[model samples]
Target: MYLFLNGEILHKEEAKISPFDHGFLYGMGLFETMRTYSGHPFLLNDHLERLQLGLDTFNIDLDLQKLDISGMIASLSEKNGLQDSYIRLNISAGEGEIGLRTTPYNHPNILLLQKELPPLMPLREKEAVLLKLRRNTPETSVRLKSHHYFNNIAAKREAGDDPGKEGLFLTKEGYIAEGVTSNIFWISDGKLYTPSLETGVLNGITREYIMELAGTLGIPSEAGMYMPESLLKSDEAFFTNSVQEIIPIHTFEGRTFPGKRGRIAQQLYSHYERDAQVLFSKNELHRS
Candidate 1:
């Protein structure tokens, strides 16, 4: 496979970075995980926009406009013969000495990699497991998609012993925040509810798109602080991500529901599938 590091393509084995990079030493960096449909990236603009937002928040001055990422991604995909693949875009503080200061960094490290999509649990049904670990505090820097992933990794390790497909993270205040790598949503009384961004949840791109699709489909949805008790009492639950799309929750921790697939989740999944077709069609048209 070929990887894009800065403006050049290199063999995967040849891709290397300095160990002294601040991103490696201090975990000062941001990243995005995206997927392709029929060899075309889905929601490229949204992902780039979020990346820029993160750079702006961190005060990283990088000119993404001059990069021609679309062409680069297309070329890489073609070179690898990738039809359905995962793309990881990473921007990190460049090589720096052993110091806490950021001034030593001159150029940001840009890494783009494509890999075969990992096997996902067939969402033909919905399943979820409740995790015992609480999410990081609001002041604990959970908003940025930084390389500091140990917390989520630890939570997943603890959740591994459970029988569910995914872990649902709760805020320290006991309100539902999100899953380890996805957003959480539940249906109650014919309305959809999810945790608010103010609760320190990462504003996921898929979560935003799903909310917009729900609105268009006439599915009532809102984001606010929600307790586990409310989720347990809800009619149905599901999780969303770029790859998973929308997956229903059959069980939470040890609690089981009447159905594996919730009605609202099913409806939303149908709409999401349609949207994918439209996006691929548009991409094809643009290429033609």
Candidate 2:
């Protein structure tokens, strides 16, 4: 695998960051996980735009104009022989002083890594388990994809007992917010219902795409505050993320629901895969 560290390409073992960096000391950093198809990155512009937004919110400016990220990703993919890969982009405040103050640091640490793609859980059937965790609202940290993910980590650990696939999180007010790292959606009476952004969710890229695709496919969908009791009303449920794409939820707290592998989820997954193919075609055209 090849890693791009602060504009230089190097072996993974050769790349390193400082211990005193604010990103390390206080978890004051932002990151994004992306994937590539046929040696081309999917939704590069969207991811970059989100990264820029995070930088602005954190008041950390980087010379993204001179970075040539698309070119870098291409070259790294060719060098690493990566046809399909996972890309992790990270930026942190460079080595700061001992205290919680920003000192004279000219260089912020930038880490871009590309590695072999992991095996995705098969999508022939969708299944998930709901946990008892609630999500934080937008008033907390909705704008930034920061590194403070311990809450999600804790929730996952607590959910290990359930044998189902993904873990769903309800809002503090008992409305469905999202999964551990994905957006939540359910189908009821031919209509799709997902928690609105007002519920303090992450506004995931996949979630946005799903909404658009649902409209194109004539599947009525809406976003609002959804309660746990609403699951009983749903014909099917699934979670969406950049990597997982879309996965079906089978059980919530040991209670099985209808449409665990229902027709609606299957149709949505088919449309989503078609969209992915379109993305790959666009990337290939750009490369040509």
The top-ranked prediction according to lDDT is 1
**What's the count of clashing pairs in each model shown?**
2, 1
**What CA RMSD would you report for each candidate?**
3.6, 3.6
Model 1 pairs whose backbones collide: 126-248, 130-253
For model 1, the superposed segments whose C-alpha errors exceed 4 Å read 102-106, 118-126, 138-142, 161-164, 258-260, 277-288
User: How much is 211 displaced in model 1, in angstroms?
Assistant: 0.9
Per-residue lDDT tens digits of candidate 2, residues 1-288?
Answer: 678888788998898888988888987788888777666676676677778777666667675656788888888888898867888889887787777664333567888888887434355334555567666554355546778787788888966754446677887888877888788888889999998888888877777777877776788999998787887667788787777667777666555655436788888776555555445322233232
RMSD of 1: 3.6
Using TM-score as the measure, which candidate wins? 1
**Model 1 lDDT tens row, 96-160:** 67878744345899998999874332454455766788888533444888887887998889768
